[model samples]
Target: MTMTIGILTENVGVVGRFLACQLGIEYINTQPLINARPFKVAIAGSSHV
Candidate 1:
């Protein structure tokens, strides 16, 4: 098994890149996807507020 890390944030900026570089991991920007699909997110087994 391999270990990996992914960073997801609303804004993609230098901070994300810097963290990825320092940690040697991948940084994903969710802004585009959010823009394409605006939906409500609820945690599993939890009631929506």
Candidate 2:
């Protein structure tokens, strides 16, 4: 069986990782998802660009 979790927050650094660890699942951070996408301008702008 396979399941996925999605966590949205202003900042998920510690909390997200801890939950993923305790649940024995993978944690996807913002940077990897951002990097996998085509670069574009956000309405609020980005530090990456």
Displacement of residue 8 (Cα, Å) in model 1 is: 12
lDDT of 2 by residue, 1-49 (tens): 1222232222355664564455554555567456222221221123223
Task: Give the Cα-based TM-score of candidate 2 against the true structure.
Answer: 0.34
- Candidate number achieving the greatest TM-score relative to the actual structure: 2
Candidate 1 deviant stretches above 4 angstroms:
1-12, 28-49
The models' CA-based lDDT, in order, is 0.34, 0.38
CA displacement after TM-score superposition, residue 11 of candidate 1 (Å)? 6.5
In candidate 1 the C-alpha lDDT for residue 45 amounts to: 13
> What value of lDDT does candidate 2 attain over all alpha carbons?
0.38
After TM-score superposition, what is the CA distance of residue 43 in candidate 2 from its true location, in Å?
28
lDDT tens digits, residue span 1-49, model 1: 0112222222335554454455444444356455322211211112222
TM-score of each: 0.30, 0.34
Q: After superposition, which runs of candidate 2 have C-alpha atoms over 4 Å from their true positions?
A: 1-11, 28-49
